[model samples]
Target: MPKRLIAGNWKMNGLKAAVSEAETVAKSLSEQSADCDVLICPPATLIAVFEEKLTGTAVQYGGQDCHTNESGAHTGDISAEMLADLGCAFGIVGHSERRTDHGETNDEVKAKAYALTRANVLPIICIGETQSERESGNTLKVLTEQVENSVPTDLDGTKMVVAYEPVWAIGTGLVPELSDIEEAHNHIRATLTNMGIANADEIRLLYGGSVKPGNAGEILTVSNVNGALVGGASLKAADFLGIIRA
Candidate 1:
């Protein structure tokens, strides 16, 4: 099995003061090694500061998003190359918020993911069904379409992480049953294998959405659930550490 990755997505939150939270996580990990890999994705503005503070520590940092272009006339957008230059080890694409707010399509997400691979940064591609889709019994269909359209086939030896973040559950303090999570993850794995990824089994599938320490251990234990894409709970050192410890 591949090493599990517990990644925190700080989203549009975080300020200079939030550096202390990351520092504490780094310090704790240094003192006591974690069983899984630890990563924190702060907003783009804080990546450099995290790189400086988290260097030589077990914790890794990354960007929340990146542009499909390396460098361009597109204003207010940061490219994958620029994120790699700032020491980002990974970048997230196709997150629900991005899809809803920025009107990002699967093709655009595929382009962005490919750009990250070219920049030598791993891409964490987000895919999930909304509540209506799930209630309508279209969860697996939605995942299949997203996987086929958003993920690029030419990875060029770069391994991309896929995060399953159910849109309705995000920040709603609601979580799916263990059986539901298992089913979704299994379907995702099978889909990847059918897509001809040579290392499909080795690829990590993360479950995101209202993942707190209270449920981290149980959720992580589910088959095919290799890790988590934590949100609000990751904002505090103690809460985040508790999930890590789980």
Candidate 2:
């Protein structure tokens, strides 16, 4: 069975004060039965600190992005090895924000994914379309190409996670209907299976964008959706836990 994972992405948000929220989340999950895996990706600056705060707790810390190189001259870039060293069991690659703002390409994301795999850090690869593409009926076309290029042929589903967060839906309060999410995830499953992985349904797929506590349960039950890639709600302890409960 696919693991139920609720991943909170802190994005560009988080400060000294935000550490307390993560501490609370860690405590809450630690105190409860571990039915679902709870992970949080704060900004790179908070990775080490949050890891320290999350020690001995069920809550795990992750990084929003990681560099392909294990060590290099890439200024301002964090690496998968470093994330693992800092206690991050997972990392997110190719988020829409990184694709749009960092000029990351499919091949670059793929390289990062492979690097994460080699470093023993799970990479949550993201792929989605913008409003324009959806308007033009190119959603599947875009998603297919991304999956074809972003996911490596050799990696098994256990090595990483995939998130489908339509660019427009991210941070925009606009989400695709349940059917649309199902279609995208289904297409992803087919694409992965064609690449030679069996039991691909056990691959964890997350729905990002506009995900909150209120709508989390409804979305989680969607076919093949293992959990969520939450954004805004992740910044708050209460809302983040609510989603985990959902």
Candidate 3:
């Protein structure tokens, strides 16, 4: 089995003062051994600061998003190369928020993933269904299409991570049943295999959406749940550490 990865996504949250929370996490992890990989994706503004503070720690830092181009005239967009230069080891693309807010398409997400791979940064591609989609029983179909179009065809399984974040659950304090999560992850694994990814099973599948210390242990233990893509709970040292210790 691959080493589980617990990642924190501090989306649009965190300021200079927030660095201390991450530092606290790093200090705690350094005091003991962690059985899984730990990653924190703060706002782009904090990436450099985090790199400086977390240099010798076990926790890795990354960007919340990146553009497809290496260098371009695009305003307000950060490129993968720039993120790599800033010491980012990973990049997240196709997050539901991005898709919903910026109207990002799967092709655009795939381009971003390819760009990340070129810069030697792993991409954590997000995919999932909304409340209505799940209610309509189109969860698997939605996942299939997202995986088929959002991921790069030539990308290696081990070089990327896939996070399943149901739109309805993110920050809503809602969670799918453990069996549902297992089914979704299994379907994603099979989709990758069917897409001809030779090492499909090596890909780490993460579960996102209101993951907290109280429920993390049960969620993390579900089959096919390699780790978590934590949200609000990740902003606090004690809360994030609780999930990690789970």
lDDT, candidate 1, 1-246, per-residue tens? 668999999999999999999999999998999999899999988998998999779889988889888897999999999999988888999999999999999999999998888899999999999999999999999999999898776563238899999999999999999999999999998988788876777778999999999999999999999999999999999999999999
Candidates' C-alpha lDDT: 0.92, 0.89, 0.94
List, residue by residue over 170-244, the lDDT tens digit for candidate 3. Answer: 999999999999999999999998999757889999999999999999999888899999999999999999999
TM-score of each: 0.98, 0.97, 0.99
Candidate 2: residue 232 Cα off by (Å): 0.5
**For each candidate, how many residue pairs have backbone atoms clashing (under 3 Å)?**
0, 0, 0
RMSD of each: 1.0, 1.1, 0.7
The top-ranked prediction according to lDDT is: 3
After best superposition, candidate 1 residue 81: deviation in angstroms?
A: 0.6
Clashing residue pairs in candidate 3 are none
Error of 1 at 91 (Å): 0.4
- Name the lDDT of candidate 3: 0.94
